[model samples]
Target chain A: MTLELSTLVAILAMAAATILTRVSGLFLIERVKLSGRARQALEAIPPAVLMAVVAPTALMTGMAETMACAVTALAALRLPLLAATAIGVVCVAVLRAIGL
Target chain B: MTEIIDETNTGQKPDAGGFMDGAKAILPLIAAVLPVGLVYGAVAAGKGLSVLEAALMSALVFAGGSQFVAMDIWTHPASWAGLGFAALLVNVRHVLLSASIGPKMTAFSTPKKYASMLFLADEIWAIAEMKAREARLTPAWFAGVVAPFYASWVLSSVVGAIGGALLGDPALVGLDFAFPAVFIVLIMNFWQGRRTGAVLLASAIAAIGVKSFTGGAWYIAAGALAGLAVAAFASQGEKTENGETVE
Candidate 1:
């Protein structure tokens, strides 16, 4: 019900920082021409970044998380996103429940 | 039924397909994000953030990863400078995301494109990039994904803030894995055989290595850069194999 000044300032600052990160890429894209290795690099960004983001959880978290990640990847190949995710979640929950 | 604003003016009125396609495509992610949002709101509440504050942060900042990091580092008499810097570091990946997707938004006008960048959450960007590979990425479609996802995030956070304490640990049921699970699925979608394998391998090695040592958000940048380097090198190998002279 109440908003404090310091919290508001922090939130606004975070918002500003986020907006800067989001929009700066547009400026970079506008300035750069995509071709050759540059195009390859840009194309790789999606997978590379996604892999980077999830790498820790997939490989380093624990046996349960790693196994669930593998299950999800396998299911993703044949199943819809929702089904694959559900299987992964169920796999991890079961694995965790068993004290993995 | 969200009206899709056709940014590419072919004299087309707002069509339902443009928006509906996007909404349908992002529906799965919405399901995944709901729990995550609830967890975030609960976390914020646990960190002593008021319900209004939690809702405001979710509505304004809108990036989940950085918001979580912010909560981790949150303090009374909050340091705007510290939180702001952390937000930048965690979300620096968006630079690559927006750069990759910017040129693909052929359907968006310059203003519209810039506007859309503000809402470029990871799920939205990943889905949009996938769509662009197979079809045209229209503004209406982008709006459809953003609107529902954004609303769900903010609303869920509000609900969590109000009642998250009663929900107890999300991990007991493995709701926490939803994010990485969804990410794994997206990575599978983006897989392009062995070259992608090389990229992923380099990224995973670098990410794990850096995470083990430095430990923070730097692992993401390190892994992403390593992957990019491998890709650039692989492309160079392709050029040489094709007998194309290197510049």
Candidate 2:
């Protein structure tokens, strides 16, 4: 219920920054005509970004996390998204329980 | 259904499957993000934020990764500049996401396109990309996913802020692994060929390297740049090969 002035400022600042990132791309699209190498680079963004976000967790976190990532990736090959995520959650829980 | 709607409509026909399709597609993500929202709320409460503050942040920022990072470095009095910069760095990827998907939004009016970007979180963007691959990206479809997903995040944050302590640590059940797990699945879906493999490898290496040295969120930016560099270089090589053949 209590809203600190400083906290409010910080939250607004974060929201502004996020808004800039979200809208800036549309601006870029309107200005730049992408093709060839630029198009290739754009195509790579999705996987690259997703990988970068998770790389530290998947490879650097711990044995349990790395193993769970693998399990999730393998399950994703066949299982639905929810099912694969469930398997990964269960796998990590078990691995942590065993002290991995 | 199309005929029924067409008779009542003046010119714009509701994209028949867009909204429902988006809703159905986003259901799994909604389930996955519930625990995450709860965890974020719990963490905010632990960090001394009131439930109202937590809910406000969730609703406004709506980007989970940077929100977590902000909480990590949250100060007593709060440093708006520092946290804002951190959010910018973590979310810079949205620029690339926007560029990639912006063009696919052929069905969206210019204003609608800009308005929709406000809700472009990782999950929403990912689902939108999947939808685009199959059909024209429509406003109704995007709204469908955004509505339910956004609601879950805000409501769960409130719940977590109010009752998070009773729920205890989420790591006990490994709920945190849900996000990376979901990302891994999404990555697998993005696999195109050897090119994708190269991009993923470069990204992983750079990310791990930067994370080890700097020990912060710079890894995501570094890794993304490295991957983009590789794809650009690979495309350049292809262009050269084509030139040689033309000779």
Candidate 3:
């Protein structure tokens, strides 16, 4: 069901949904007490989401992306962030240059 | 009786200097978000969205994860409900962020507090929380972080949208790799020994598994949920942040 709603409507709906989320945690906390485990899980979520976002792309994409991400991950183990990014970018560039 | 805040917690009220102070504080985050904003613009433009539409999404939605996924799945006759739901799920984390900032923001007038939330991003929230721990977290301090980041986000997206036309292929120039690499660094920071590793590994497995099974980016939220479950289980009797083993 594509274009079931107009673009403006869709955008507005998404924004409203996002704002609801922004306010909900605060709103709920006042009435509902979140257990420590719940808070810990929340703390753990952002990284997991990031992992989810990238892991699949690396899997489905071609060598350039995979290598770039691998280099980034490996470099991440030891190097600072910007340096690791450079290494990843360069690795992918080199791989792509060779027609991989 | 008004609850007492310590002296360190009662610094200058948000003043005219608050805006400038915030602008300066966010310089590093501004630099960090710039490329992401550019890539978002390029990606959205590549999807056939008009420049105005892409910029509008960035300005209005202002959530990077949802925006990226939405753009990825965008097609003619778009699935509006799917986009809305996916964005809602991905941003569910913001519920926690907003709540964490809620007590500190109590100092602000209601309108000021709500207005500040409009531009809240992961980085902005982190900065505000950090400020809160250190001392008084003025709404101005929060706005200071938001100002540069918000400007950088919207403007960089505009530049990338316009540049996308001239640049032909963003992937060829290696812009695509930048975000993944950047995220790798961000993810690495969240690393907390095996506990974190286990959660991340499971989440990645769940994500990749779902991607293979369904071929949908919605796996991101699914995987995140999986990790949350794991973290909840892992939390029982875990070591505290201060290196004290909790029973």
- What share of the reference contacts survives in each candidate? 0.81, 0.81, 0.60
- lDDT of model 2 at position B69: 76
Q: What is the lDDT of residue B157 in candidate 1?
A: 94
User: DockQ, in order, for the candidates?
Assistant: 0.64, 0.68, 0.51
Candidate 2, residues B1-247, lDDT tens digits: the string is 2223322453566665667877888998899788778878888988899999999999999998788878767888989998898788778878888876888887677788899999999889988988888787767788888999999999998998998789777677887687678779979988877878999999999988998898546777788889999988877654443321111
Lowest-lDDT window of 10 residues in candidate 2 chain B? Answer: B238-247
CAPRI-style docking class of model 1 based on DockQ: medium
lDDT of 1 by residue, B105-125 (tens): 876878888999999998899
Query: What's the chain B TM-score of candidate 2?
Result: 0.78
The top-ranked prediction according to TM-score is 3
**Tens-digit per-residue lDDT, B1-247, candidate 3:** 2222322365655355766777787777777788788888888778876677777778888888788878777766666687788788778878878877876765576666667777678878877877788676666667778877887898988888888788677677777777777777778877877778878888889888887778446788778888899988888865667632254
Model 1 DockQ reads 0.64
Q: What is residue B91's positional error in candidate 1, in angstroms? A: 3.2
lDDT against the true structure, each candidate: 0.85, 0.84, 0.76
C-alpha-based local distance difference test score of model 2: 0.84
* Model 1: how far residue A21 lies from native, Å: 3.0
Task: Provide the lDDT at B191 for model 1.
Answer: 88
Best of the two (1, 3) by TM-score: 3
